[model samples]
Target chain A: MKPEELKYAKSHEWIKLGDEAVVGVSDYAQHEMGDVVFVELPKVGQKAEKEKQCAVVESVKSAFDILSPVSGTITAVNEAVAADPALLNQSPLDEGWLFKIKPENPADAETLLTWEQYQVFIKQA
Target chain B: MAEHELRRTVLNETERKAGGKMVDFHGWELPMEFTGIVKEHEAVRKSAGIFDVSHMGQVFVTGPDAFNLLQHLNANDLKKATPGKGVYSHLINEKGGLVDDIIAFCLSMDRYLVVVNAATADKDFAWIKKHSEHMSVTVENKSDEYSILAVQGPNVPLMMETFAPEALPLPRFGIVEKDIHGRHCFISRTGYTGEDGFEITCPNDIAVQLWNEMLELGKPYNIIPCGLGARDTLRLEAGYLLYGQDVDDDHSTYEANYGWVVCLDKGDFIGRNILAEQKANGVKRKLTGIVLSERGIPRQGCRIFHEGKEVGTFNSATYSPTLKKGIGMGYVTPPLKPGTLVEVEIRGRRVKGEVVRTPFHKGGAFSKVLYTGKDK
Candidate 1:
């Protein structure tokens, strides 16, 4: 997923908006995490702030926090992510999307990233 | 320090490709593992596996006072160590907690070698050097001079025969004196995986050749490369304690279930009197093993419960490939014994378990097995 289609945070979170804004971690973050096992998703209707930690992802050997990419009220979550966390390893961009939210301000994500900008950001990382 | 990617001398470039999932450990990047933990773990149990253990630190302590240096630094007695033999001991600070657990080997009458945990190597070396200045001893960090590989399993030695059969004649815990494939090599019959295996060390230049040669030689046997992923699970299955996670400088050997190595009978040494007094008075805490009776795996730092209250926390945990159950090691209030019922909190639920002996080796150490049964 291009960082431009979604917003990104320096903390490694990325968000994609379609129907509802979907949030997940970046490829850079996943690579650094090494492996993906368990993911702790925030409950439905939880309010989240930009760059705030909203969920947790666990690998076989490690556990890490997932920061929210855009401030919003979570409306629905991908239950499949929790049932089979390996989705992150398989298709991190499509079926692997984490949770959904009805953002208070969708435009607020404008400052997050552009496709080219995220590439530069990742290189800098 | 996190500039581009962290790299350290603990592991080499070839080791990075061996499924190390490189992590920055004390300024060095080393593989945590290559394949998934469960599969890699079972490989060591049922067959043979290789571990890139280059991250471990090797330090040389020499001079006339080398014996005196070891006596003052380690909690265990080193005066009885004969050449070519090694003994496990605790490197400790004044407070009696362990700085690191190390293997001290007597290389020669005046030369000694100490193998320490990679993360604590600098601290152990610095501490050894800082204290040795007044004792007429000199410490040199030899970590950069070598790369290590631990070929472990039931058939490691048998498999090594194809590559270097001459090493087979060396006794258990024996160290070879020559080079392998033209590289300076030392092979010792010891391993962290609780197997009858060798920790092979050689000059960095020949590491790749030796690894390739071992692979070629081991091809007939299905020996696969293992990473730290399997390494941890194997050690956990064997009930070995990791330095930073399972123990620290704040915990003494008396409390960690290693009193036999303390050797209080051998006159005064660092922490000897304290260990003796602790032994007499009974240490306040003890490290014990646990086998969970629930489905969930108990992991590190998980709170351990006894009855209703929180009593301890698991230091390390894993699902044993042999026992096929969740097992762990942790420190608990003293008087804890085998069959003592306890619980490990996993995802907020207290799973039932019982304290067991240090290690319950299923079918003996994984490497010592020789299949007399016909290949099925």
Candidate 2:
């Protein structure tokens, strides 16, 4: 189950909004991608446009693009996940968070789906 | 495809119960992975793993003219495959293109068992039958009647001691009939993963029992049920070609870098004239291995460049779990030597790489036990 405190994107990324918006893939996303072998994390101070490709997550079979959910300036990147990609599969929500984005517009979180809505959205997908 | 519409092996339910993530593989509902591809791949390299390979086809030929029929059809010299031995050969068409690559096991002086790729099973059988019209041989497709399990790794020899002791002394590519759980099965010391292992072919009735029993017996060795995902990665690491992906009807044995299997002096056979001509003149393009110097996965159809010009395209490529880098095999004209610098175009970006010798993961059983009979 997705955390009720977070909002989700249609592309499967989940964001927790605060002073700095934190982004990571959802539980369903990690499960669908199978094992994560490599993670190309976005850089700090980089521009992250809403719904734009910001990072790359590669499994043993193929690679996937991780899009930013909210337009912002990247503040922090996860060094731990960059070193060990399996962290994305093991603990995708907390330790596996990709990056921190200082949102350009905090109200953009309202445009993203809520936890309950994301549950329904994935079911329909 | 609907779940019910897909074909299944006898151990399909057993695999699902073991938490296999099922997917459609050539119309068969098989597990793409169990625990995970990297984990399963590591298990086989370090310990042991089991694979359900029942999707492969088995064709039996028997009669007075069985030997002659296969001898004429296979590009390799089948005469060397005496009874109880197997020969890996390419079935080439009259145009010198591959029909399929197969392992023909000489069961007796007048009977042979041919194992073929799953997707080319029907075509291979038809090709064989079409060639044997005048020959007195009975060709039968026994794909549905049998199930094949590949038990592979560094720990296979030790595991076989408790599981099937009779399989221990068999040499590589050797086949022996052994009794397991009151049923007879063919245990061949052969595998695609470059491991010292056995491919056990048994009737479908005993498949479930054998799978469960092998898993239970192999617990001490950390044996896990591997899936097709790991199988592909493992084979790629070993530099073994996938039939339809790495090689197909468009390629001949010489161009595919499998000329070693083509015995030109073995007398008359299908595609012999063209293959001999190619052998005499050498191929224009040859299959070669590539390893990336940097991060980034190179996938199939990725263009390969040399000296800032497009030279070839990848036929099969993957992230090597063993090497922790990008590796692939592709056809490059005027084949590049090992260590030659090149670049691969991935996602419109050129990544530097180098040509390398194949069987990329050299620490497997083939390097250690199969040749020296001692662990490194």
Candidate 3:
């Protein structure tokens, strides 16, 4: 689901802004990765840098890095998705959310792409 | 430096129209996936899947001395393969390093067909010609004249019954010439996948037509078109050795876990002395399968460690869809038993795993069948 309220990263990760921003890979990214078999999640309270690899997702044929969309400290992680990696392919934007980050700079969301802009950006890619 | 242009097969446009994700593979433009790797992989295991294997090379050898030439060139005993039969063999260098692994088909007493790897086609042809200087055999490369389509899985028999009647009654490793929808094709009951399947070779003009017919006949059986992505994982899970990765010029046949295919008792051939000596003593390292005990994916070039000491590296590795765990093949020091514990360095962390018997996911038709030299 392409929610207008959420921001997108060029690397295909999505961020939902709030008290604690929810971060995940977009549906398009999951589609491109094929069936995800394993997800290595970052531990809670770990600091992450923007545009840097903070997690890993492994498919049957490939392994891809899930870069953090914004610099933050990970406040929470979705253990459910880690247990069943297929959830990422089935609902990448919803129940398949990866983790929640407490951003160091709350205004970082404005630096990301809007949902409509992401749709166009993906087309060009 | 000039960029070399990539070649496309006869079914290239058809594959593109069917949603195949194209990629450059060994100088050929081909599909890496159709629907998706896992979906296509599952389709082959559960039902049937077709692959455009036209990028593979085909060479023709014909003369009164064809058998004599092949017997001296191939590592496997060529005398066992009668007409209408095919056997997998490796063409080796004088030092026992692999030149290229191939399938030799004996069409008649004086004619033989050799299918070689796409990347090594030209080199293998030149090597064969150099070896046949004194012999009267004519070696011709006919890779462009034909296209190959592989229909693989458990549902292949039903599809053959509808479209390829001649191939339906053929025994395993048997090759038969057949007319399908007015086009002549060579159908062989052999495939790289560990499932019961068929490989049909036809002229380029009718290649797309044959593919369409096979798809139509296979429709009821839920046939899906697969690409190279699934082909790699399927063969890896089946314990089949890939040429460049698993077996190459550095490793001999015995070290590659294909010692069974080598006929040491047979008369003199290329690398026979090296192979005989290796058999009498032993190889320093052997190719073995590994399955991870923890949740981690082992990748190519990953280091294998035993008690914190590096022993070898993974040559080919993938996440097995059937086993739901990381599975791989690598060259490790010998004397490592099937249950020997080891660690694979995935990414940076050491993941626990164990050396195991190959053909990781069993219960396929090819694994169960007992070949008795007869058609079922």
Candidate 4:
């Protein structure tokens, strides 16, 4: 079962919000990518637009465009993600969170897919 | 979410042998890894491995004026290539863009074989054909007519001994007509994996049989069937340049470190004058090697920074299994030395890196020096 705390994007990005939304790749994404060897994340303080490419995740073969889960200003970037990239392979939905963002519009989280909703949404794919 | 799919670039015999993970490369479906990349890579280094290169394109140039036409088309000196010998060449565009990198084999006085990158097969064929209007050479796209598989690494001579025991006596760049599993084929001791190996060319129908036979014979040496994934990492570690990544039409032979194939002394080819000028002068952007000093991978198109100033961009990269570190090749401006300190922008972070003399690691599997007492 997919996690309950995270919301998903059609582009396969996922986010978890407490004070700020922490963004990362979905479990579905990391699964399809086989092994995650590299995570190219944006830096803290960078502005990210919703539905726009924010980072790049390279697998054993090719690179994929990682989209932003919400339009916001990046507050914190997980530095550990760059050192041991295999965390995406082990827990893409959790510890692989790319960066936390202060959303431009807090309502943007409502536009994303909820836990069970994304489960059904991805099921069709 | 979409249904999980296995992308294929080219279906070789090994993928058909059982289950294999395939990936899309330049719109073509090809195998990524078979029998695991680490294991297969080690196999090619220690013993032998067969690679399905059928996805790469092949062209047959024939007619009386073939040599004349090729002299103008490629960056290599066609006259220097003796019959049955192969030479690596580049078919550049009028603007000096690389149409494709190829290994052309002079089969006879009037016939030549050209192998090209799979992604540019159609475009390369059309480009060559369109330009051939002025010459009497007949350009034929024979990619469908044949298949090529490379048996490479240290134990290749022993693995292929059943077919041609005397093949051990052949030189590094040798070619011979031999039989594999009772089928006649053309064998060239040439490769892209920086190894001592043979590239076997035979009809499509007999391709499968030949692949299986080689695997059976290679059993003792622990030869594995490798896919393009490991192939890319292997070539990169050897300090070799890939056509699409490290080079393209936007770059020149000298800039790409492929000036060796230019043969400036052989009169003039299409890009000869331009290459000569560049050699006498110097190329603008130069292809150089980079080692990631920090913990991060520097991939294709990543910006190279010199003290926070953008210098150049990376062409391609990977976490090298041999080096146990991230290494890549890329184009750079002046002032970047083999050990020059640089930074690669990974995500938004300026990851520390250093320029290194090409070939992050030695060819432990292909070169003779790496092998011990025997024919290795």
Candidate 5:
């Protein structure tokens, strides 16, 4: 499902705001990285600065960094995806969400690309 | 960092049509996977798959002194590759480091064909040509003139019989010149995946047609178009050494576990003195296979540890589809014994692994027939 409700980052991370913001790599990112075999999640309460590397995603061919989409503290990490990284490739939007971050400034989420902008950004890439 | 422009194989269009994900491999736009790495890998292990190996280089040495020239350059016994047969050998530098590993086919009394890695093609050609200056042989690089398609799997023989009947009965290490799709091609019963298969080399012009026809005929056998990703995984499961990855210019045959391919009694050859010395004294480091016991996948350059101390580094690693486990090879100091516990550092985390006897999954076609004496 292409979630227009979620804002995306230029680095291919997606974020949806609520009580806490959910973070995950974009669908395009997961498709490009083929068969994710492992995911390194940040610990709960770990501080993450926007645009910084907070997690790792690895595939058979190579490894990729999952950049934090917003300045925040990781509140919860989805262990299911970590246990089976293929979840990222299979469902990058919902069940594959990586971590929930309590944003340092909730308004910072607006700085990310909107669904329309992300679609345009990937087209340009 | 290189300056060369990317080149495409003759099957570039065909691969794209087959749903290949193209990637840059040694300045060549080759498919890394067609369907998916795991799927393509499974196809070859369980059924059949085809690969476009057009990027690999081929050098022909022809003259009455061809055998003598190859004998001087190759570490193995060139005489063993009598006409219609091929021998896998290492081209070593004077310091005993590998220049490149090759399969030299003895086409006749005066001609030989040496297939080399795509990345080292030019370098290998220059090295071979430089050594042939004083000999009676003529070295010719025919990489662009021809294209190679590797049809490998357990069902490869059956598929080959349907596509090209004349190419059959070619035993392991056997080479036969036959017409494929009305084009003269050399079908060799040799493959990197440890499968009983054929590597058909045909002129560039006829390559696309032949590839299409082979896939069409192979439809009933569940043949799929595979790419480099599956190729790497399959070769790793089979314990095949990859040039520039598993073995390089810094390691000799003995250190790389290729001592059997190096014939110390074969008079003289490049690196013979150093290899002889190394064989006598034994190597400081030996290549060994590592299999992960956990979920983490070991990758190339991952630091290897034994009881928290760094022991070595992975040369080439992959998740073996055949074994359903992570398998890799690395050179370690004081070589670890088979079944010795080790850890691979992946993304700063040490994953549990164990050193095991190689060809991790022994069910491959070639391994079954050649190594275990169990015909499939």
Candidate 6:
């Protein structure tokens, strides 16, 4: 089950809103992509548009893009995940957080699906 | 569009119960990975792993003219495949393009068992039958009637000694009919993972029984049930080509870097003339192995550049679990040398790479045995 506090995107990214939004892939996303082997994180100060491809996560089978949930400027990246990609599969919501973005409009996070709605959305998908 | 039903092997339910992630593989519902691709890959490398390869086709050619028919249809010299021995060869069309790569096991002087790729089974059967029209051979497709299980890794020989003792003395590529777990089956000392292992072919009814028995018996050796994901990565690391991916109807044996399987001096075959011509005047594009120097993964259709110019595209590529690097094979023109520097374009960014000798990981069981000149 997804954390009730986080918001979700249709492309499967999850965001925790605050002064700076923390972003990572959903558990469902990580489960669908088996055994993450490598991750390409976005650089600090880079501009990210909402729902745009901002990072790449490569599994043993294929590569997948991580879309930004809300438009902002990249603030930081999780260096731990870069060092060990399997952390994404192990703790996707916590230590596997990919990046932090200072949201252009903090209200944009509210526009995204709530945890319960995200669950229903994925079930329909 | 109409929903197309996928075919399932006899071990489908068993694989699902083992935690396999099912996926559609060429119209067949097979496991993409069981536990995980990397873990399964390592299991086969370090200890032992079992694979459900029942999707591979089996065609039997039996008659007085079995030898002649196979000899005329394939590019390899089948004369060397005496009784109980198998020969790997390419079935080429009249235009010298690959119909499929196959392993013909000489069951006897009058009978042969040809194992082919699952995707090309029907086409290969039709081609073989069409070519055998004038020959005194009975061609039969027994793919649906049988199941194949491959037990591979460094510990296979030791593991086999526990249950199938009769398979211990068999030479590499040797096959024989024996009773395994109270069921009669054909066990061949051959595998695609570059490991010293056996591929057991048994009746469909006995497959589930055999699978469960092997897994139970193999627990002492840390044997895990691997899926196609692991199988593909293992084969890539071993430098074995996938028929439809690395070799297709558009590519010839010589162009695919499989000229070693062709025996031009072995007399007339379907594509001997063209293969001979290409062998005499070298192929224009040769399949070469490329290893990335950076952290990114290389994938199929990735453009390969040499000296700032595009030269080839990756036909088959994967992140090699054993090597922990991106490696791939592709047809490059003007054949790059082993140390030649190249760049692979991944997602519009160029990554440094170099052409290298294949069998990307040389620590496989088969390599150690072959290189040390061991009699076993």
Rank the models by DockQ, top first. Answer: 6, 3, 2, 5, 4, 1
The structural similarity of chain B in model 3 to the true chain B, as TM-score, is 0.96
Which of candidates 1 and 3 is the stronger one according to DockQ? 3
In order, candidate lDDTs are 0.75, 0.89, 0.88, 0.77, 0.88, 0.91
lDDT tens digits by residue: candidate 1, B295-351:
556778888888877778888886565575678888887558799898898777678
Q: Mind listing the fnat for each candidate?
A: 0.12, 0.62, 0.88, 0.31, 0.50, 0.75
Q: List the residue pairs that clash in candidate 5.
A: none
The digit string of per-residue lDDT tens for model 5 on B90-130 reads 99999999999999999899989999999999999999999
Query: What clash pairs does model 6 have?
Result: none
In model 3, residue pairs whose N, Cα or C atoms come closer than 3 Å (at least 3 residues apart or on different chains), thus clashing, are none
* DockQ top scorer: 6
For model 4, residues B89-197, the per-residue Cα lDDT tens digits are: 8886666667788887888889888788887888888977887897888999988777888888878877666666655555555567676556666787777777777
What TM-score quantifies how close candidate 3 is to the native fold? 0.96
My TM-score estimates for the predictions, one after another, are: 0.75, 0.95, 0.96, 0.76, 0.93, 0.96
Off by over 4 Å in 3: B1-3, B363-365, B368-376
Q: How much is the lDDT of residue A119 in candidate 1?
A: 77
TM-score of 1: 0.75
Candidate 2 accuracy as lDDT: 0.89
TM-scores (chain A) of the candidates: 0.87, 0.96, 0.95, 0.92, 0.95, 0.95
Clashes of 1: 10
Q: Which CAPRI level is candidate 1? A: incorrect
DockQ, computed on Cα atoms, for candidate 1:
0.17
Model 5 RMSD vs true structure = 2.8
Task: Say which prediction, candidate 2 or candidate 4, comes out ahead on lDDT.
Answer: 2
* Candidate 1: clashing pairs of residues: B19-B33, B19-B34, B20-B31, B20-B32, B32-B228, B32-B229, B33-B228, B33-B229, B97-B249, B98-B249
What is the per-residue lDDT of model 6 for residues B61-168, given as tens digits with 9 covering 90 to 100? 999999999999999999989999999999989889999999999999999999999999999999999988978999999999999999998777777776777777
Cα deviation at A77, candidate 5, in Å, is: 3.2
- Report the Cα lDDT for residue A15, model 1: 79
